[model samples]
Structures are given as structure tokens and as C-alpha cells.
Target: MTKLWQQRLQRQQRLMLRYLRLVFNEFFMIAVFILLGGAAYSYAGYIKTLTAPLWWSRPLVLILLLVLLTVGHFATLLQAADSLFLLPQESALKGYLKQAFSHSVPLPWVLLSFVCGFLVPFLEIGGGRSLISIGVLWLSVLILKLGQLWGQVVQLYLPTTQFRSQQVTFYGLSLLSLGLGLYSWPALGFVFSILTASISRWRLQQVQQQHLFQWQLALNQEASRMLQIYRFFNLFTDVPQLQGQIKRRRYLQPLLRWTTGRTTNPFLYLNWRGFLRGTEYSGLYLRLLVIGAIVLLFLQQVWLALVIALVFSYLIGFQLLPFYRSYWDYPQQRLYPQPASRRQQAFLKFLTPLFVGIWLVFSLAAYQLWLAPFGWVIILGVGVFNVAFLKLYVPNWLKRHEN
Candidate 1:
């Protein structure tokens, strides 16, 4: 059983390493360092200005800590076939899960500790926490995280409805304990942590008596985690493993109709519908637009806001190029009456309005920042440039690369 677990772990690690290499390209690594530096500088500046904490500080921190501790699902590395092929090894599966949890718990604690330690200065300067108190709080968070991890394992043994209820109960108790711990009732928090740990153990024992392993549940959980990773990676590069996720999104149907309305060109229709159906493509565009708008709304510097907006516009245009090529995979698309020029036109037509809409959003945010005239010109100019670039330059560039 131990050997089996080790083999699975090594396989997962290899897969992770391959994806990690793809994720940390040189350009991405550089951008990450730049962003991290900017963040650290901003945080230091903000912390120095904090003479004292606001009333909401403790509760906000407590909530954030609770969320960090409670938010993740446990990864048991169990596959769907395990239920059938390894049914006889059910007892060993328990040991495997024990090992999994043992491996998983330390990383979150270490990360949480670093984050808490970093915020220690802020807690001291702003929230008036002593060193000893902070230490106690950190220890309490670690303990609660352990209980939460155990709770996640216990949940796999439960039916769907019961699992959800138990999850909610655990999160609520976690919040209460963290809140009490931070709000002058440290003893109560310790007691709650002990209680949660005890209850989790009791629940585990009870579930073990059934000698049942929920392989399907574990498989789904693991698959969901992988899909999330793939979705993020899909933003930067084509993730062939990614499966398109669609939502009916009845509310957006009208907009979809308006966009694709009675188009004689099949290429335009197919591309528009594909964008609407594929969550990855549409979600990426919307997320970048929102992020750009948020940066424009908050950052007092107009030039910085404009730069971010243009960068996001370029990203949106570039990313959507894949959608243009999506139809190429189907030989039927080749037989369509639409000419290649019309296909390119279709892509431009679909993307132009979307970029313009994003620009309008950013421009509105910029207007609030008192840069309306400059924002309008910058956004409009970029919007036009993006459309033209996507239509003319990108196709030839992609063809060259393909050749």
C-alpha cells in the first residue's frame, strides 16, 4: 500500500513539474517578480501610514484567516477506477489518505505562518497586538487548519447533503473560534479548536466503521482541482486537455442573439456561439476587462491606468485569436461557403465590439479618475488598433508560425 501510494505521488509530481515548467516561462517569471516587488512596496507604504487600527481590522483579519483555513478541499489522489480495482484494498486506502493529509497539512500552515508573520508588524502597529498574543493567534490558526483538513476527509465519507451541511457547520464554528480568539477570548478559541479536533476524530471513527470508501467523490474532487489548474494555464497557452465548460446563462442569451443575429456567414455564427458557450474564452476576456476597469478605477495615475487598459486590450485580442482558429479543427468548416476573407472579417467583427465594450468600461472608470478626455481618446484609439491588428497582422503572424 505504501509503495502504491508512493508511485501515485511520484506520477502526480512529474505531471505537476511538466505543467509548472510551462507556467513559469521567462517572461512570466519576470512579470511575477515585477508584480511582487510592486506589491511589497505598496504594502510597506500602506503599513507605515497606519497609526492605529480601524474598528473593522480585527474582524476583517479574523474573517480572512478563517477563509484561508476553510476554503480548500483535501486531495486524496484517488482515481475513479480505485473503487473497482482497489475495492479489496479499502483498508489500505485509509492509510493512503492518512499519509495524504499528513503531507498536505504542513504546506498550508507554513504559508499561513509566513502571511501571519508578515502581518505581525501591521497587527502590532495598527491593531495593538503583543508578540505573545500574535504567537498564540498563529498557533490557534494552525490547530484550526488541522481540524479543517480532518473535516474535509470526514466529508468524503458523507452523503452529498450531509457533507454540505457538515461543511457549513465546520466553517461557521471555525469563524466563531477565530473571531473569539482575536477578540479577547483566547481561551474560548483554544477550547473550540480542541472541540473541533475531537469532533472530527469522532466523526472519522464513526465513518470508518462502515468500511466504505467514496471513490467517486474523491475522483470528482481531484478532477475539479486539475480542471482549475488547466483553466488558469489555458489563459497563457493552448491547453489541449481543457474541456470546454458551458453554461446556459439565460440572461446573456439576448446579448448573444444580438451579436450573432441572422448572420449569413456561418463562420461568424459559429465563432460567436463558441465564444458564448466556452467559459474559458469568454470568462478570460471578461475577467481581464474587469481587472483593467478596477485598476483604472482605483489607481490615481491616469497614464498607469491607460497602460493597463491597453495591455489588457492587447491580451484580449491575442487570446481570442485561438477562437478564430478553433473552427479549423473541423474539416466541415473547410467546406463552408464562407470565404477565408469573410472568416477573418467575422473574427474582427466579433472581437471589435467586445474590445470597444471593455474600453468603454475602462473609460468610464477613468472618467471617475478625472481623465475623461484623455481616457476617451486613448481607449478609442486602442480599440481601433486592436481590431485592425487582430484582423490583418495576427492572421499572417499565426500562419507564419504554423508553417
Candidate 2:
């Protein structure tokens, strides 16, 4: 059983390494370092300017810790076939699960510790918490995280219908532990966390004694984790293994119809419909737009907002280029009487309004930041440049790649 678990762990590591390499290219790594540096600098500046912490500081810190404790789910690396093939080794599987728990919990602990440490300066400066109290808070969070992990394992024994209710109960307990610790009751909070952990372990033992391994549930959970990783990686590179999900989104259908109706070109209509129905392209566009909007709204720096807006515009155009290329996949599309240039025109037409909408969002944010006509002019100028760049460059680039 130990040997089998080691083999599975190694396989998972190799798969993760393969994807991580694709994601952490040279340019991306450099950008990440720069972004981190900028964020740390900005955070320091913000912290220094703080005058005795805001009234909501303690509750916000407590809530963030609660969220961190409760939000993480476990990854056991167990496969669907394990239940069937290893049913005879059910007793030995406990040892494997023990190994899995040890392997899984440490990374989250480290990350959670880093976050707690990051908030320390803020809490000390703003929330008026002492070093001892903050230290106690950190330890309390660590204990609650352990309990949460064990609780997740206990959940595997539960029916799907009861899983969410169990999570809510566990989260409530975690919040209670946090609340007690924040209120200068560290001893009680620590005891409560230990109790939660003990109960979770006891429940797992009870389930193991009465039930067989839940292979399907473990497999589903593992698949969901892998899919999330793949989806994030897909944003940077083409992930052929990535499966697309679709939703009917019936309410949005009218908007699609109206947009497509404005264009008589068959390719334009197809482009609009494909974007509205296809998951990857449409989802990427919206995610980037939302991220850009969030950056503009919060960053308070005109140059930074413009940089983010332009970068997102480029990404949106680049990702959507495949929407046009997807048409060539079908023989019927090739047989259409529309000219080749019409496809380029259709792409530009579809992209223009989308970019314009993004421009408006950024411009509004710029207005908030600068409150000047010059800021508006600068935003409009950048928006025009992005649209012109997309219109002139993307179609040619796609054609070149196609040829």
C-alpha cells in the first residue's frame, strides 16, 4: 500500500510539473516578479499611511482568516478504479489516506501562515493588536485549518446532499474558534479547534469501520481539482486536454440575437453566435474584462489602470482570434460564398464594440481617479490605439499563422 501510494504521488507530481512548465515561461515569470514587487511596495505605502486602524479592521481580519480556513478543499489523489481494484485492500487504504493527509495539509498551512503574517503589520498598526495576540491568532488559524482538512475527509463518507450542510456547520465552528481567539479567549479557541479535529478523526474512523471506500466521490473530487488547474493554465497556453463547458444562458440569448442581427455577413453572425455559445472564448473575454474593471476601479493610478486596460485588450483580442479560426474547422464554412476578407471584417466588427465597452469602463475609472478632461482624452486615445491595433494586426497575424 505504501509503494502504491508513492507511485500515485509521483505520477501526480509529474503531471503537475508538466503543466507548470507551460505556465511559467520566462516572460511570465519576470512579469510575476515585477507585479509582486509593485504590490509589496504599494502595500507598504498603504500601511505606513494608516492612522490607528479603521473600525472594521479586526472583523475584516477575522473574516479573512475564517475564509482561508474554510475555503480550501482536500485533494486525495485517489482514482475511480481504486475502489474496485483495491477493495480487498480496504484496510491498507487507511495508511494511504494518512499519507495523503500529511502531504496535502502542509502547503496550505504554509500559505495561510504567510497570509496571516502579511496581515500582521496591518493588524498591529491599524487594529491595535499586540504581537502576542497576533501570534495567538496565527496559531489558532493553523489549528482550525487542520480541523477543516479533517472535516473535509469526514465529508467523503457523507451523502452528496448532506455535504454542503456539513461544510456550513464546519465553517460555523471555525468562525466561532476565530471569534473566541480575537476576543482574548485563546485558550478556549485552541481547545475548540482541538475538539473539532478530534471529532472529525473519530467520525472518519466510524465511517471506515462501516463503509467501503467511496471511489466515485474521490475520483470526482480529484477531477474537479485537475479541471480547475487546467482551466487556469488554459488562459496562458492552448490546453488540448481542456474540455469546454457550455450553459444555455437563456437570458443572454436576446443580446446575442440583437448583436448578430446588426450584421448581414454570415461569418459575423456565426462569430457572434459562436462566442455566445462557446465557453472558452466568451468566458476568457468576460474574465479579463472583469479583472480589468476591478483593477481600474481600485488601483487609483491612471498609468497603472491604462497599462492593465491595454494588456487586457491585447489578451482579449488574442484569445478571440481563435473564434474566427474555428470556422475553418467545418467544411460547410469553407463552402460558403463569402469572401475571405469578409471574415476579417466580421472579426473587426465584433471586436470593436467589445473594446469600446471595455474603454468606457476604464474611462469611467479614469474619471474617478483624475477628474480631468485630459484623463478622458488620454483614455480615449489609448482605447483608439488598442482598437486600431487589434483591427490591423490580429487578422493579418491569424492569416499568416493559417498559411
Candidate 3:
């Protein structure tokens, strides 16, 4: 079981590394750097503008810290096959789970440290805490995270009835500990965190003694967690492991009818159907669109808003390009009466409205931020980029990769 855990971890790591390389390609890396640079610059400017902790600073920081504490889960790495294959070894599963939880700890801890470092200024300058107190506060949250992880470990062996109660206890402890840490003495929070972690450890031991491993529950949780990771990766590149759910968005049938002209072009009709019904393409489109719109809405600067709009617009079209050949593997598609050129033509036609719709949403956000002239500029600028991407970049890309 131990070796099995190690092998699984290594395989998962290698797969993630492979996707990470593709996800962070040259252009995407440049975009990420630009985004980080802009964010840092904006953060510094906003921090400088703060005279005192605004009225909402304490509660806001507390809520954010609480949220951070709630994030992350115990990764068992147990698979469906494990339920049967490893049944004999179930008694030793505690050791394997311990290893899994330990492995999961470092990433979230590193993330927590970075976030705390980022919020340090706000804690000190805004909430009027001493540097040492802020350090104590971080330590407190760190301990609370351990408790949270232990609680998750306990959850795996619990029945649903017990699980709900455990969840209530977990949240209650988290809230009180962090609230004390932020509002009262930092040491009080630290003390409560230690107690919380200790209690959670006791709870895990108790649960292990009283209950058997819940195989179905454990496997289901692992699958759900992995699916989320795959969904994020799916945004950057196709993830075969990610199984998208098909949604019958009946209300969207009208839009499909108008776009495909009732199967005038079978390829176009198929693309439209897949985009609307399959979660993969439509989910990606909506995620980018909403995220881009939110970012643009928040940004007061015209240049920043324009950059965001153009970046998002390009991303949507670029990602959707894969849909052009989505049906090629179907041997029946090769026998379509339509010429090969029509596929490309239909793809562009399918993408045209998508691009236009995304641009319009972004333009509206920019308009709300800075009205009239700037909004018109954003609209025109994004429209031109969309046209250039479709006319210049996409064709060359498809041609270069042509079968």
C-alpha cells in the first residue's frame, strides 16, 4: 500500500507537469507575467492610498482568513479499484492516508504563507497590529489548518449523520479561533488553534478506532476533487481525463436554431450543438467571459480594461479552435458530402458570433467603467483583434497543423 501510494503520487505529478508545460507556453507565460506585474503595481498603489484600516478591514480580513482555513482537503489518492483490490489492506490504510495528508500539506501551506505575507501590510497598517502579533496570527491560522486537515481525515471514516455534526464543529472552532486571534490577543488565537488541532487529532484516533474505512465515500470524494483539478486544466488545454457533463439547456435551443439555420450546414449544426450542450466548450467560454467582464468592470484604467478585453477575446477564440476538428475522429464525419474547405468555413462562422458576443460583454463592462468614447474604443479595438485573429492567426495555425 505504501509503495502503491508513492507510485500513484509520482504518476500524478508527472501528468500534472506535462500539462503545466503546455499550459505555460511562451505566450501564456508572457500573459501571466503581464498580469502579475499589473496586479503588483495596482496593489502597491492601493496600499499607499490607505490612510487607516477602513471600517470593513477587520471583518474583511477575518472572512478572508476564515476562507483560507476552509480551503484544501485531505487527499487519499485512493481509486475505485482500491475498494476491492486493497480491501485486505484496509487495516493499514491509516498509514497511507497519513502519507497522503502530509503530501497535500506543503502546497496549501506555501499558498497560505504567500497570502499571509501579502496581507501583512493590511494587518499591520490597516488593522493596527504589531509585526510580532501578525506573526502570531499567521502561526494561529497555520495550526488551525492542521486541525482542518485532521478533521477531513476524520470525515473519511464517518457516516453522513456524524459528518454533518463534525462539519458544524469544525466551522464553529475555526470561526472562534480566528475571530479571537484577529479581534483579541493574537496569543489567544494561537492557544485556541493548538487546542483545536489537538482535539482534531483525538477525533481522528477515535474515529479510526470506532469505524471502518468508508470505501465508497473515500473514492467518491477523490474523484470529485480530481475532477475539479482537471476542469481548471481543461481551460488551458484539452484534458482527456476531464469528463464534461452534458446539459440540456433547452432555453438555448432558439439561439442554436438561428445560428445553424436548421442544419443547413451539418458541420456547423454539429459544432453549435456540441458547444451548447456539452459543458466543455460552453463552460470555458462562460468562465472566461464572466471573469474577463468582472476584471474589466473593476479596472478604472482604460488601457488595462482594453488589454483585459483583448486578451480574453483572443483566449476564447483560441480555445474554441480545437472544436473545429472535434468530430474528425468519427469515421462517419470523413464521409460528409461537404468539401473539406466547408469545415473551416463553418468553424469560422460558428466562432464569429461567439467572439462578437464576448467582445460585446467586455465592451459593456468597459463602458460602465468609462463611458462613451472609451467604451467605443474598447469595442472597436476588441473587434479588430477578433477579426485579425480569425483572418491571420487561426488559418495559419490550422494550416500548419493540417492533416
Top TM-score: which candidate number? 3
- Deviation in Å, model 1, residue 76 alpha carbon: 1.1
**What Cα-based lDDT does every candidate model obtain?**
0.73, 0.74, 0.82
The total of clashing pairs for model 2 equals: 1
| lDDT by residue (tens digit), candidate 2, 1-403 | 8898899899988987877786565234443454455567779989989987688888998888877875556878877778788878877878888888888888889989889889989988888878887888788788878878887777677776666776676777778877777766777887777777666677778877876667777888888877887787677555777867777778888988888786678877877777887788777778767766665665555555566566666666666666777786667766766667787788778887777876776667556766743456548666786767776787678578657
lDDT of 3 by residue, 1-403 (tens): 7898899999999999988898776145555666666677778788888888676778998899888987787788888888999999888888899899899788778888989998888888788778888898899888889988988888888888887888788778878888887888888888888988898899999999999988998899899888888887877678899777888899999988999885566778888999999998898889978878877776666676778777777777778888877877767666755676777778878888988888779878776655634656777889899889988988887776666
Report the lDDT tens digits of candidate 1 across residue range 1-403: 7887789889988877777777575134443454445456667888989987767778778878977885555777777787788888777777888888887787788888987887787777777778877787887888888888888888778887877887787777777777777777777787887787777777777877764767787888888877777776666556778867877777777888899888887777777778887787888788767766765565554455556566666666666776767886678755655566777767767876787687678767677645444645556656676767766777786566445
lDDT value, residue 37 of candidate 3 = 68
Q: Give the least accurate 10-residue stretch of model 2, judged by summed lDDT.
A: 26-35
TM-score of each: 0.81, 0.85, 0.93
TM-score of 2: 0.85
Better of 1 and 3 by lDDT: 3
Rank list by lDDT: 3, 2, 1
> CA shift at 303, candidate 3, in angstroms?
2.5
